[model samples]
Target: MAWGAAAILFCVWTLPFAELTGTSVTCTFSEDCVLPCTFKASSDEVIHWNRNNFIVHSYYHDADDLEKQDKHFEGRTSLFKDQIKHGNASLLLQNCNIQDSGQYSCHPSTTQGAQESWVDMKVHAPIRSVNIEKIDEEVICSSQGIFPAPNVSWTTDPPTQSDMLNNSTQTTQDPNGLYSVQSKVSFMGNVSDYAYICSVTSADGMQKWKTSMRQQGGNQLPSWIIVVIVVIGIGIGIGIGIWIGIWIWKKHQTEKNRDGVGNPGDQVPSGAFIAPGHDHVPPDEFGAEYELLTLWVTQKLTMPGTSQDPSAIREFRGPLEPSLRPDTIVSVTGLSQQTSLVQVGKSPC
Candidate 1:
């Protein structure tokens, strides 16, 4: 460590340069970042950026040259030429990554004198949402697309004495070289006594992050859906009740007919007969047959006895029950012209 420190100090003191302005520039992972290096320069000067003696970027002859640039930084580093005329040779690092965090030296030299400066870069990862879900009835806690392969583990709080848990875990790299981590702890009993937390620590150990599954709220169906379901159920129930009432009413009517009972002003039971007369009845219960018979009988009783011949006042007789009114009105469809010649009558008992 002492040797390493001495070597760095010697390099800094020996360089024909000044310290880079400011402490450090911070950047997010998978983003672009700029390393500040401002100084007056001629378009003819050569500019070189190096990290640990490896060329990160080189500009000479008024253009960039990657012949000596490190393979690790291939196509990932460039210098600002538009501002270079204003003495700005700031380096733009493309797709900033965890491995890119380090000290970089920017040196521009002319025949008169060479000046150099060093800049520090710090790369960070934005915290990702940890997912909590139930798969096949087992609890799962997972995080994805994180940089530097974070450390993932389960914990509980209000702080349990033993912070460790038995779990299944896997870590995989994404296409962009970040990490995806999944971890699940077996849980069968006593959920109320404990709440789970998914904790992540970046490989560099600078970040400690945790997410609580319980704090994210419930996954049950929404309240509006429940309310809609209840309303639909009520509508179905009402429909069923109306259908039952109609069925019962029809069944009662069928049973009434079978037992030889009938609606008001109905004809007598099958073995009985009727004598026509006006019978008072409740309007809603009157049958069509009884209505015709009553009308015919009232007309006959009111007609003048112009045909005084004894045979003209004819009467036909039959056993009659008090409950039935005569209902024998049928159409003799083609006989209208002989109406007076036809003598219709009732027989005496």
Candidate 2:
């Protein structure tokens, strides 16, 4: 029986004794995070947390000991001192950053045994707002304050081939280790023909943001083109105004001339005849030649004993008759004795 008990004690001591527990922890950038660990409770307890064999935090003798802590974790790591007796060896990491993301191991020891807990930490700065703008022939999409880099993609309402889309993207990291991404897509044809969409995704694919832009009709026209159109419109308006003003002035002059011609005191040129009881005969109606012919015919008809026979009427020379070559003679005929009248140059004589 002693041999059996000795063998059992040897077996217990030889068996695998180190307990290992693993969990995942997600942390937001610039925020506090806790890596949980638990062990068997004991009066004399010891705790140590390490990442990649680098000391993150250590506790012993019922107090914190950070003299050997990594420089990167200085003033940024702590332990829950009151909870250590309760088998809680959780590490409080302050102001978490992207560099702090990795696997961490928590080791706790006591009179009972020692155990190791693993925590996989991930630090993320999620994507926020996506901004899209159209500048000339290019469309730009951008986002700021992201962690672990980001991805950018461009799409159109009427989807286009990847090769056909002329695009370029760039990402930059600021001093705070946050990423800013910008993408530009150049278009060859009319901007109003398609709608451009830009999507920004975090590196971990846990967050996404999208923005779309469509060119409006007013925005499609170039600034210089708009200016030219306005200038042309003004020129046309001024030309029309000038033409109307000239037409009105000419019409006024014409009306004034007509009124002057109709005045009773207006003098007529010498040798020009005016019909009885008429103040004036506008030259536009009956020319000077016609008036002179009418006057000569009237004087001849008023003479006493003038021949009344139509056959006797023949060509006769008069004071008002215009001089003519021998080949061209003025002839007066087709007279009516009762009315004592003749036709001369389309006017009744």
Candidate 3:
């Protein structure tokens, strides 16, 4: 297949023309393209337009002559007879397709001799649409109905470190000699978020398409993450509340002590108080010491006690009641090593 295509291209390269005209004229798909030429011939002179010996349009003696025209160009080729006197022998080819791209020549003959001028025609149909698909780690890219043997290539984005890529392409010519191309590239299984680019280029210019096959499951937040966040937030709120409560309690205690509600060396009916000089203590530490002292007194009262026994010197009898006694003083620790203690009396066990 390669050799056959090469031979066809060789023949095209060897095609002859009288002289090169201004420049190659470009035409869009299914549109008209002008193969321009100029001459000083009269309307009475004969003009012949052709592409590599294929009849495109013919005129003789001031009128069109299609008796020898090719069937493919039967009604789609025309010449402007009104402009012939102005030295314009341009030919208009309509509904241009891929096969219409080639070298074109206009031969205008006068009574003296035949003269020719030529221009190349480039008919283009860029790839207007492209589709890409991925199936089981294989990616396929395709574009259809392009013209003039377009160039096709495949590329990967976030380029793979692997030097070798599993890439392949297949191009088939249509009935109109246009092209349909498909490209495939493979990769290791189970890869995601990979992008691919496919491009086609020709004398008409270039066209490209990019695609990826990554799927996003959904937009909602995950249940586990949301649960964790709520739990953490609750824990923080509880911690803050406890801290605030302790601070409020300590502040109240300090205020009461300042007013001499129950200062150390001062006695109260329900309890004896320590000196209120530990103003430098933090609220949290002060609250902890106060709670510890309260718990110690409660525990001692639950146990049996015998006040008459020398070994139980601090013990008191059942039916104990709160009483302010000099020996019942509790030491509190602070700037003065003033420890906090609670007096205890026991019930019958």
Q: Which of the two candidates, 1 or 2, achieves a greater lDDT against the reference? A: 2
How should the candidates be ordered by TM-score, best one leading?
A: 2, 1, 3
For each candidate, what is the lDDT? 0.63, 0.72, 0.63
Provide the lDDT at 155 for model 2: 87
TM-score of each model, paired residue for residue: 0.52, 0.60, 0.49
* Residue pairs in clash, model 2: none
Clashing residue pairs for model 1? 17-116, 315-346, 315-347, 316-346, 316-347, 317-347, 317-348
Q: Residues 1-349, candidate 2: write the lDDT tens digits.
A: 9999999999998764789989999999999999899988887898999999999999987988999999999999888888888988999999999999999999999987889989999998888788988777788999998988999998887787877779999999999899999999986475455778899988888788889887554336566788899999999999999999999998877544323223343332222223323443334443321323332223223123654545533322232433211212122111111112322222223
| TM-score of structure candidate 3 | 0.49
What's the C-alpha lDDT at position 307 in model 2?
41
True lDDT of residue 154, candidate 2? 85
Per-residue lDDT of candidate 3, residues 1-349 (tens digit): 9999999999988764344345578787788877888876554678899878988899888889999998988899888878887778889888888777878888887664567777787877777777887655466878787776666666656676544567888989888777888888775444545566666665345655554543223122456777899999999999999999999998887644433223243222333323232323244544443322221121121124643345432321111234333324343333222345544232122
lDDT of 1 by residue, 1-349 (tens): 9999999999988766544444488789988999988666654767899999999999886799999889999998888778776778889999988889899888876543566888888787655677777554345878777877788877775555443455788999866667788888754343444566778787878777787654233334456787899999999999999999999998877444323322345332321222235342223333222222221111122225633344433222222334422222221111111111112234333
- Stronger candidate by lDDT (2 vs 3): 2
